[model samples]
Target: MAESLGSNEVTFRLSRCRQSVPRSRAALHAVLGGWGVDQDVLESAELMLSELVTNALRVRVPNDRQVGVRIARLLEDGLLRLEVSDAGSGRPEVRAPGDDETGGRGLLLVEALAHRWGVEKRAGGIGKTVWAELKAPDIVAEPVGREVAAVMVRPGQQVRAWGKWRAVRTVRTESYAAGGLAIVLGLGEGPALRVHAAEPLTVRDDSVPSARERGEGTPG
Candidate 1:
């Protein structure tokens, strides 16, 4: 059973599976609809929820993993926030899309439709939560004229096969970059993926490469 944390937030604690995703997605749609979100925004919100929830379930550890999604509104700014989280160490990456790929296109749609999107470490550093924000169309006193551009990203795969007599063939290709770079790497492989930068990405007295890029640190 799921718990309601008040403040208009609904939490569903369920396993990662094909069946659970649609149900969760539907629930989000209903809840957002009740909030008077327009049809277009409602569809986009549903897509974002579906993609994130699906990712959480797909990449979670196989040992009875529990995934959760939270939807709430910012009372101050009247913005809706959508969060999908899992109790796994895997992070999320964003990248450009490649041709000849199936699936992994959901996140690209989310990034395009959402007003702003980012990832942050879950409370207590046990997991990560990917979130997105959308402006309430009904209540826009002073609209920002700036539009965020969406990137095309998808997922590809490597195929290995044996042909005719006995020769073996292999092909390596991108699986997905939906939403940007949707690949996350943990600290388990040799020469762990790291990005070095000569300058800081921001003026906050820091000198680390941006985290949204591929094969960087954990999301957040």
Candidate 2:
């Protein structure tokens, strides 16, 4: 059984070794398995993650510094975003494979499989993070909090706002108003929310291989 952290998401600071690749991958599979991600999306995520981490580890940087891997559920867009950060500033490029080349196509494979991909400088840090996004299969499972499960915000049902689950002041569902469904709640203080995968509701909150776990495996 994996250790549970109150929050969802994991960030593992990998050592300068190949093992980090698999470690990160396994962590993804474990977390996604618990969240009930689609098998196909999970597989693709594993592959893309491996490539990014592999590239990060392959960079000829100091061994003392560590690489970082983050797996996040982009619920707003229904995307699974995998990011690998390394100290090296070199931007990875997809190269065309030579007829006799045995390797050199990691990014190419990433581009082919990922729904979209990009690289960005680490905010408030050195180096950059190479990220890829994969579309998650529509699985309408409910996104739940520690005690309350997510459901359609019906009238009278309390909701999160400013600082507490304030009484759901009101709900609007006019086709001409805000279009579809919209919730009226104050900003801030509310606990983070989730969206159900298979239903029309709002709520809260992947895999590669087998490897040993090391580094700060903070839950993603």
Predicted candidate 1 versus true structure: per-residue lDDT over 69-141, tens digit per residue: 8888664686778888877776676645677777667678778878999888887657888898887534222
Model 2 residue 190 lDDT? 49
Which candidate leads the pack in lDDT? Answer: 2
Roughly what TM-score does model 1 have, to 2 decimal places?
0.58
Model 1 residue runs over 4 Å out of place are 139-220
User: What lDDT, from 0 to 1, does candidate 1 have?
Assistant: 0.57
Error of 2 at 115 (Å): 0.9
Q: Which candidate has the top score in TM-score?
A: 2
lDDT of 2 at 165: 38
Tell me the tens digit of each residue's lDDT in model 2 across 159-211.
Answer: 54342334443343323243443333322334333333223432222111111
For each candidate in turn, the TM-score is: 0.58, 0.62
The positional error of residue 193 in candidate 1, measured at the CA in angstroms, is 65
